[model samples]
Target: MSTLSIRDLVVSVETEAGAKEILHGVNMDISSNETHAIMGPNGSGKSTLAYALAGHPKYTIDSGSVTLDGEDLVEMSVDERAKAGLFLAMQYPVEVPGVTVTNFLRASKTAIDGEAPKLRTWTKDLSQAMKDLRIDPEFAARNVNEGFSGGEKKRHEILQLELLKPKFAVLDETDSGLDVDALRIVSEGVNRAKETTDIGVLLITHYTRILRYIKPDHVHVLVKGKVAEEGGPELAQRLEDEGYDRFLVNA
Candidate 1:
């Protein structure tokens, strides 16, 4: 059964000129324990799809419905969506200078789960997760993403995925701007998250490097704001070998 479903989704953004359509009748179904990768060139509306799925205010859903585990996701607020088992790891993680990572995690857990994590048990789990991700313990006490490097910011996003364990996660370009080592670490964290939970993954990326580590069960080509093509993992290899020209032509 699909954990998340987007049916005939149409989204537009408001600009000074007028409403500009970004997604045009796109549909997808992601199932539990499945990893799906959406790949497309720049301006193909990949990130727009992610934001739209998360119910971002900027991207207006012109029509269609989005459901999470058969629940109406389109009607829920962003925080409600999170509480309803949907998570979006953004392309650009925001930095808050005053909020420590520990505090942020606790608050998010409380908000999503309806109560704060028990101090003794939650901290132990948090420490173990940090250690597993190779993040220093002291980093938790520091402000969230404030002084973090690009890779560190990505790791912090993964940390939340681990702690929160949402039912479905839309990771927008999680592999961007990371060195080889950081990529592996981040991939490992993603793998760990999958092992610990039955979360479905929708990874949006341009590069194929991350796929080498975190193999996708399915690969989709997004072009002209829609899925131009889709196939098993071999489709990702074809894109890696031959580039997107063939797909663009069909798109």
Candidate 2:
């Protein structure tokens, strides 16, 4: 089974104030079919961890290691990380001015698989996947995330997740700007991807609303760049009611 193991990961970021550490020895392991949630207050370095995992170049790994199914991701480039079955759906997906959604998706698939998928099969699958996500058929011709609403962009992220079928996905604040309806739909798409591909999820969010739809096997509360608490689904409910005040206070 595919597995991702992060051990004592210490990350730093360059700021106007110079290099400052964000993540402080984060330790976690996730295998296929498992859902792990990282919840914390704003500026708690939650998004930093997500970006670090995806090798964004901004976050530097000062110490520790990240391994996927025994391969060292800490030594891999961004695209190398993706080829190793790692995926990150950004909170704000950037627009590709001239690349149509169709071309982008197919190109991404080809990159991941090292060979182009049969055009006929990919076409059918893409159509069905969009329909399932309730996306407009005409969207295939539009540039990626171009002219799309917040909810549409979020759904597009899921579409990539569903199509790419990565072994692990780090969804960073995917619910940030989504409404109730859009949240439900995106959450359902995540569940579908999990069930269909047994993909491990490292869901990072500040609110528990997304947890209401995508149940997590493990919930970790990141406080001041460290895990202050961790529990099952019940912990998420507690976080919803009590907020991160208790953790922050104790920290």
Candidate 3:
């Protein structure tokens, strides 16, 4: 089993007026077979944390280190980090005009795993995953997120997670903009992935609705780029009742 560790991680972005820090010495660890929920309001650097962890170029690491199973992740490129067993499902999944779902999934799998899957077995696996996620087989022929609804896009992300089978996944606000039915389907997909792969998940969200379905192992309240409070599932309930006011003050 692999573990993702972040220690005293500080991230900054280049601006017209020098560097602007977004994350402030954040620290956390996620292990295989565990799920961690990061809850915070807008502009609290939740997305920045996701991007930074995924090795996005725009976010500069000012200090500290990110490692996976004792391997240094900060020294790797985005593709390298992905090959090292990290995945990020973006909050806003992009529309790639000419790429079909099948091609994209195959390419991503090849890049991360260093070997192409056999066509016959790959198709069967893809079909089963799509069915589990309640995605239509026709979607495999369509362009990636080109005309997908919010929930469809989210499901597509989960489909990638299922097919890629990464060691750790950071879902960046995937519950956002999804309708109730869509939310349930998406949540079910996530649950299925966790069950099948023993994958570690860092679910980033602002509300507790998704938590109700996924049942996080740990819930953390992130305020002003820091984790202000950490606890079990009950912490998500308290945040739902009290909002971030208490945590914001403490942060």
* TM-score: the better of candidates 1 and 2: 2
Best by TM-score: 2
Candidate 3, residues 86-195, lDDT tens digits: the string is 99999999999999999999999998889999999999999999998899999999999999999899999999999999999999999999999999999998888889
**What does candidate 3 score on TM?**
0.97
TM-score of each: 0.98, 0.99, 0.97
Candidate 2 Cα deviation (angstroms), residue 148: 1.3
RMSD of model 1 against the true structure: 1.0
For each candidate, what is the lDDT? 0.92, 0.95, 0.93
**Tens digit per residue, CA lDDT, model 1, 6-73:** 99999998889998999998889999889999998999999999999898888999899999888999
Best by lDDT: 2
Lowest-scoring 10 consecutive residues by lDDT in candidate 2? Answer: 242-251
TM accuracy, model 2: 0.99
Error of 2 at 10 (Å): 0.3
Regions of candidate 1 where Cα sits further than 4 Å from its true position: none
Can you write out model 2's per-residue Cα lDDT over 1-251, one digit (the tens) per residue?
A: 89999999999999999999999999999999999999999989999999999999889999999999999999999999999999999988999899999999999999999999999999999998899899999999999888999999999999999999999999999999999999999999999999999999999999999999999999999999998989999999998888988888888
Candidate order by TM-score, decreasing, is: 2, 1, 3
